[model samples]
Target: MWPPRRSGGGDVKHCYARGHRDSGLVSGSSHVRSDMGDIGFKLKVLRRIGIIQPTSPARGLKAAKALRTWGPGFPSGVAATAARFPQQTAIHDDAGDITWGELKADIDRYTQALKDRGVGPGVSVAVLQRNHRYLVMTLVAVMQAGGRLLLLNTMASSSQLTELTKREGAELAVIDSEFLEVAKNIPRESIVLAWADDDAPDDLPTVASISADMPSDPHDKPEKSGQIIIFTSGTTGLPKGARREEPKDLKPLLAYFGAIPYRGNSTVVLAAPLFHSWGLINFGFGLSTAPTYVLRRKFSPEQVLKDIETYRARVLVVVPLMIQRLVDASSEAIEKRDVSSLEITASSGSALAGDLANHFMDLFTDSVYNFYGATETGWVTIASPEDLRAAPGTAGRPPWRTTVKILDENGKELPQGETGVIHVGNDMPFGGYTDGNSKSFADGLMHTGDLGYFDEDGRLFVAGRDDDMIISGGENVFPRELEDALIEHPAISDVVVTGVDDPDWGQALAAYVVVKDGQEIDADGVIAHAREHVARFAVPRKVTFLDELPRNPTGKVMKRELPDPA
Candidate 1:
């Protein structure tokens, strides 16, 4: 262990930190056990999921000690994983492969460098980089130094970044050199380049430069763990920064393991944006599972096929749009790769349309798991491949230890099969937005701002955004229902239904569709399909054909960019 430095503040521990109780750090025992049922369940789930394997008694013991030394949260995950699996491949990026030991070495060096820059408990550090090894190191470093991590979206505008950096009060901003122009106006003094250019000045700070000068001694264990902040989906407006700390209860881990079969140490190609909560969840989960992550700065459907074959990846993590693009890729492109090693293909970040899910499953294995939740609500539900196959578009039931309720505007609980706003209760609840804004909560459950209902099998079927509910021809209608129906048509590969102004009806539905390749279907066919699938009033009045739909990074439709109905 590195020589201990004094914590600036006295050792003030949060009662919620499970590291003290069950990390096996405090006890120095080979077998990590806890009296608390939650922590015990955590270990059980980890072991059950092949995360806490009996590799070597000595290594396991070392891992426990490392966790104790690093305190709770992301820091401990890095340290403990390194101790247990030093030679194991941890990260695979464009920079090539890095072992767990190598990653820990880099993170260990930067943790001190980060602390020297006045980053610790309650301190804030903003990161603006894509998915890469540098991004991973910076994440662990900030957390090790006990600083709250503000994850900025790569798609944010310069003005947005400037306003956000200033409003969030970020003292330091770490950015990729490629994004230098975008981050130029961000109010920050300590700007560290994440990915620098070859011709960059030697004096300028970069992750590689500071990591090279890493101090031999590790920073002192933080008195408290750091927090993670992700932004809300800004499809409609400016995204708000939603913050959260690691859940005090380990039960949430069980819920994750129960829903998604991400085995420990498996190779996975994660194409989802790391700045989002969906990607962040797997990133955090990998701390214990220690999966080999194959990352690319930018996603490419063609490159993903090659990456999977090259790495023999067992799991493929993606957003729905990526999946759609993959499915749309030429038959020759997909036929060339040996992606048979894939056991799980998980989808998150946005809704995975039922028909799209079915088409994806038809091509690949029936191993799709579409996660449904928002930044404000932590993992509200998970739909397994079976759930998707049987129920099609139904969001699977809440996993272990999570509760979901349908509530009316007055906060009254609605019965099953009744449409209402979605409210969620989970161990990892949202800590509200960084600007002191928060989601509506009812009796301690947070509102999801979505309208959905429970089916006979207790599955959730989201109608659409609660605010998107429209009245057409004096009849209440939901665009999602119509879009869902239209997407099922074989000729149509993609569709989006929205409320458009109409002289005939105060509001009418308008659909923008992308016809499947080699198909000769026309607007009349689409209208006929919708008419057959949905109610008369819910049918889209206007059908506009498009080559493709505008989408955000996470596969969410950018409805704001849609053209007004002709």
Candidate 2:
């Protein structure tokens, strides 16, 4: 075990860190000395020390000084690795492989180009494109230049993008060539530049000329310097922009890297779209950890397996749906492919179906993990491979850094094994809503709208979203639990359960399904099949066959868009 150093003043030092063990038991907070537990003591200690003076090197620029131990113009942790392993593969796509050195060079060139474009600190640049090596480079350049980075979904309607550009007053948009037409919708004041791929840097003239200046240290950047702004589809209508700033305490995120056990010496496969927080964070953290990253523009079961074999990836990060899709894919190639190198994998964005989680563990022989977090709330809890083996549906205990409290509607903490809303926050919490009209992170905790509870053993189990709850025939139902049962049908490939406005039952359960190829199934057949697994009241009264379920760029089911069943 690595010995603990004196935690710089004002920082909370954890007592114990959850390390890797083969037992599949998830770890919890270290023991606190002053009566309180580890996280509880740290909370009290941080409250005791007021915000540090900006000029003090011990506090003001801690992140910056950490960077100086490396090189110049390298703001991200990944840049340091390039100097050590220049030839190793950094990113793999149809475009070809990008070496660590090549990625660093591309970022430097782009950083200079962005400077020429009148972009600098406090300026927010929106990027609208799919996942690719170029997107990764652009993100690093924005952070390197002290500019706020905003990710724009290419799938958004043109009108939506236009309003967002105006709302945030985006200074410029770096977009793919295919999105140039959509970029025209932005007001005349904002500039748009096409992302240059292989050709000559023709747009360099448009970028403003500026000297290469690195922050004297990571801590030198303004505390309010917004690093990334991710827009979430609002339940009501438009999207909400969730801005994540650089935290004064980097220990939380850095701990995530260590806890997951996928840093340096490993290749992290990125199968999810970069537009989502999960994909974006996975990419950024990989850079900090200096692990090789493999990218796929879109998820395809066959392509994913092939990439894993080709890259010899040791770590994989993806959503539960993607995991299910890959697992459902033909196994003739699966058995033949060499996946024995994989040591750690993470599933996030949604809950892992209990059965699917079991199937994955059985197939992987216990190297799969599940992390619970949201775009709004950073890292909450994690169910490592060991933890999941112990409790199949639990989201695991809170991360070594964050604190969680399950509270009922009355805002009081609920007793163990009782259901309530899950609230999480810590020193690493990022303030929210930079759009003026957005949600602010007022309290120390982020109220996750998810309904869940903690077991006697402190394992978190998610029930469903507070909004997704369905009241049918006066009985409460969570679509997620019912949907889990629907996927068990042999004929069903993918399914979504939603509530349809009903006259008699207040609301009725409805199912939208995609059946396997050459498979035949109908509404009654699915309802009858699901009835055997779940209560009759929870079964869908109506099932509509669809080619696919509507999802946002992040692969989350867009329940608001599902058509009403006839």
Q: Pick the candidate with the highest TM-score.
A: 1
As a whole number from 0 to 100, the lDDT of residue 123 in candidate 1 is 87
lDDT of 2: 0.66
Provide the overall lDDT of each model, using Cα atoms, as 2-decimal numbers. 0.77, 0.66
Clashes of 1: 0
TM-score per model over all chains: 0.88, 0.81
Question: Candidate 2: which stretches are off by over 4 Å?
Answer: 1-74, 83-87, 187-226, 234-236, 437-444
Per-residue lDDT for 1-67 in model 1, tens only?
Answer: 1011111112211110001222332211124434575566666778866656787988888778876
Clashes of each: 0, 12
The candidate that achieves the highest lDDT relative to the unseen native structure? 1
User: 1-566, model 2: which lDDT tens digit per residue?
Assistant: 11111111121122222211222223443333332444453443333221111234543354345355333222545455565556878888767898877777766776766766766788889888677776777777777667878888777778888888778878887776566567668643454443434552454322212213422122233333336888885534788888765544445544465346663547778887787778876776565555678876667878777777887888888888887877787878578777777777777877787577778767654677777888778777777787788777778777555667666666766554456666776444455777564332223456888877655556777768877877777666678777777787888888888878878788888889999989999877987787677765677878898888887655577777878775
